[model samples]
Target: MNRMPVEPPRIPRRNTGVTPSPPFRDRLMALSTNLRPAAWTRSGIAGGATIALFGWLLACAGAAGGADEVRAGAQDYRLSGEFGLSVHQVGDSIVVRWMTDALVEGSLEVTTGAGDVVHRDATEAWTSHRSAFATPAEDSIQLHYGDADARHRTWIHLAERDPRPVRITGVDSLFVMADIHGEYDQMVGILQNAGLIDEELRWTGGERHLVALGDMMSRGAEVTPVLWFLYRLEREAEASGGRVHIVLGNHEIMVMLSDLRYVHYREMWLATSYGLGYDRMFDPRESILGRWLTEAPAMLQVDDILLAHGGVSSDQLAFTVESHRDTLAAYMAEDLFHRWGDTTAFFDIDSITFNRRVDFFWGDRSVFWYRGYSDSDTLTAELDSVLEHFDSRIHVMGHTPVPGIREVYDGRMILANPLPLGDEILLLVRSEEEGRWRGERFRAEGPPLPLEVGHPEG
Candidate 1:
């Protein structure tokens, strides 16, 4: 189900006299939010593989064809025919919306963990409508939906919970890949060659940490499958005691709000053909990939090393590492497009209060958008200053594409975005007794390739 719409249900609506907010319309206005777009470089190897997967798209065509009679209650529903629906739990309210052909009729029944009905509504006939309900005090909600005859019945059980932090303190081995840009084959090949997963794509990295340093979306049509695969791998790795951390990147920020400059046409086609806008197809509250991505961090730390999609400047490190993580995590948990304007103060490079305002998600100098690593000649001192602010030894970044995994600033900063042109991974092995970290580059074949070492001449 990489690209199909999720099953939907109806629910009670709050009759607020005032007009409600628009559907994902608001965006934060900012200057120079993204760096110059990297030149488009299509992988011949990736293109061949991508062509082969078109059959997969055809195979999934049936799921998106539509259904007429649908029902949901104790179990999740599969949307079929002309009826489509989605639900979002926002701030203690259950919001539901639907799209259906004319003369379609359905009923919505919401209940607590017990069989007690909390809210119920019936539509004699509906073309399409949006509704919301004040959630009951129960921790779990059971939604039941069907027509008047109840022949097309369906059930969905939802539980509300806060996002949890995924911390990795003691890990002997860690492998990181970044800037996937919808290059699914390249991502899988590197993971398999690195022994992170087997040919079946099962997790083989036991107790090790596999971190995807972000920019997983945009630039290609395979975004849906690429993200779903990563979501699956995350679960698989967790079962084997290994961890997969997906840090957010700028491209992710752009796509969430329908910024389409770099988006591949096929993605937009698939989404629109299904009666969904590009952003709606991947809405954080509706799509599995979107939901998983929304919970990921913009900045993550393991021991002495800090990793983010883009490098975070020293000034942005004003807050304690935990505070930085918590703040960014909270931002991603909500409607990010609307809430980010409050963070403009942190994006200012010339701010006198740079250390006081923490902005991890936006702006050129923020964690997910900074480009100082590639532009600066005096990177060693520059990186040291940033690391010193966070009490960290090293900073690993991924927004800037390089020929291969390279260490600059005397190994204080590592640039790990192996573009489609060059497929590579950075393997970091830490020695607990020695209190040191060693890094190497692993290409598709042969032994570990050592990076070009040495500090730039002062």
Candidate 2:
């Protein structure tokens, strides 16, 4: 049974109650202290009470600045100058208002959190223009305007800060594992047995980061334990100054969408008995998994390592840095999920193809199912074109499972699939001081499978 698509709830804009302390605290404290010995003390007390009351009122007012009222429009909008304001639903376009004194020509760059520039325009004071931006991500529109007489500049942060990809520095190695496919008990056993993770399932490497490439759910009987273990490992890694980056896999995508194709019978039985269909079990809109997956990048790069669930197409490699981020985010949004399992979309030659190729449910050469091909030479050539375009030397991926870790195209890429081991494998690529990367594979060994148990055909 295919799992249903679960929509994540819309993000609400509300005061988190984390506000900065008043900058004039010393002066206010001094005044309060000085007035304690005179009739001015009572007056000061009353005055302070009044100010406190007004401050509370202002805080309440600021809190009530609801996103519901902020319609996307062409009208000029501004919050009070004193607050760190947020503008929601700025329509399909957002116009930055500049004071006449702060006008200059050719000095605005709108960039997303992934550091993609969305719009670049030259303007004078009070300029208004339509932004190509539609959906929101962590992004900012910076303005470089004003004259030599009085320099002025400002930036409007257009979205909330995302969990920025942390740079893993000072580590000699990095490991990536993917598509464990619901074999969580085996995964945990393998990691503990191998010593890559402690008995408690925490990564033990200094300065190293572990990336679980995706597919942490489905097929196996112990999916819940596996997710719980990884969730714990995520916290542990962060606490130890190491990192665990979990990307989205097709199985996860299935659950998020309530697509029952990949779900095991036992899991489905439990879900159905509880009156919870696949959608309710894993709605991306309401589930923590949904939010986390939304933020996962389709591709990641570290030193010489180019990590993506599926290989990039030739055209995508040609995108400018800014365009790539926008293109990828647009591909990952919910609407694309509506079109899952559709092979025609994946094979479209002119489209970006990340969603179709990387995010889609099934295809011959897709990450989830590609086995060796007689056309390996042609595939290699296409991949070479993309890698050369990005100036990258080696690509590591796990979408297509291989027997152990295998090198292809004379080591232009390494396919790391440690799924059957019960423990996720980490590929530690050690970078030399001069910045060359060397690969080392780490497997978490667990209790051996029963003799009767057979490996899945990868």
Candidate 3:
């Protein structure tokens, strides 16, 4: 008698906070095992796909000249080239079919409007199906075929003209996330459920901003997607007159200087496991990430609220934009190989020492380092001094991962670590009154498991 094959159980949507089943673990292991044999096979398939796609693209390019085309504007152009290929949107999937005019050998490049390269296929017979995600901001998609004599390209806009301003009149709310550690999917789910991001991944808040207290990279498997999502969100928010503040965290500095050997072996393991290639991945020549990181401010002021990663030092008590900028510049110029390299303002090796009364950036010790210390009093004093200097009553930070939202110094400083048990935890900051901001903590309660930490340095 023949037996039917067992189907792998489906993993429930993570938003419900339901613990993943043991079968899910088994399934993941099985999938990984199955992938090993097909690794080279897939590479070959990708190569074939690339060639096919580019070949078809070139054929389309040949026909581009004869299509009913219009130069919409300086930046906006449309061409409906004639091709034997069929292009149509069925439900949420875009089905594209075309025959290659001539056998071509190369890769295909799809460039997005924000200057981001999306799909790079290096296979023969390129064919792919992508979901049609709604885009709120003005965006364009470009298809590039061949290296030389290969100028085949198509651009399409995926946004409505004159989009309505994000409605935040009664919202008066802000979302605060910390220690995301490369959990892009979870973060997006939380934001979408909370109404911070629309279904199309566009910002929906008016006059409100989302404050991420830092540590965005260095863990989880999908750091690239996480950063890309945030980058898009920042642009969308700015377009809608809202804002997104990404505070610099200690881990960020570690990832930035990973090439200089400032990061640890374990952190490097985390980076590699999560697909973060520190040295070879980020190109110092282009320096996009470096430029973005250098521009990130140490502290951001929203109404009367002060937001920062790690914490503030005593010297930064009266911190201004100019002062922080100068300090950051000085720190960036330091040589990591030197003895005094770690002592720079930007390099905080001893997290505990940061919040010390005399040392500055007061706290018990380096929170990430986790040295034994019970100097809460000194930390409180330093916090008071900072509050007085800034003239702000509340200071919010996310360096230490607390079990839940912790109110230290009688609510003067809030320690918000949204990655409790390496699961999902995010804080919401809402404007209760004209000038008052309230911090609300949300936690996903379920089974406990070790979170994979990705440190790109390794």
The model with the greatest TM-score is: 1
Better of 2 and 3 by lDDT: 2
- Model 1, stretches more than 4 Å misplaced? 1-162, 332-361, 454-458
lDDT of 2 by residue, 1-458 (tens): 22222122111222322221233333344454644333322112343333333332322222223223212211122211101111123345553322222233424455654666766655543322122335345454443333333333344444433643623345566767777766755676666664557775567754567777776766554454455456557656777777777766656755654344334433443343234454444444433334445555545666556665655555455563235545545655645453443222222232334324332344434433333321153477777776777667776666555446655666677666653533346555555574666555545444422111112342
What does the lDDT read for residue 281 in candidate 3?
Answer: 29
Report every candidate's CA lDDT: 0.59, 0.47, 0.45
Comparison by TM-score, 2 against 3, better one:
2
lDDT of 1 by residue, 39-149 (tens): 212211222222223212221231222222111110132222112444556677776544333357766777776788888776666644455688667755655655555
Best by lDDT: 1
The whole-model C-alpha lDDT of candidate 2 against the native structure comes to 0.47
Instruction: List the candidate 2 regions with Cα displacement exceeding 4 Å.
Output: 1-171, 318-328, 331-378, 419-424, 431-434, 446-458
Give the per-residue lDDT digits (tens) of candidate 3, residues 46-77: 32233223322322232222223211110121
For model 2, the run of ten residues with the poorest summed lDDT: 78-87
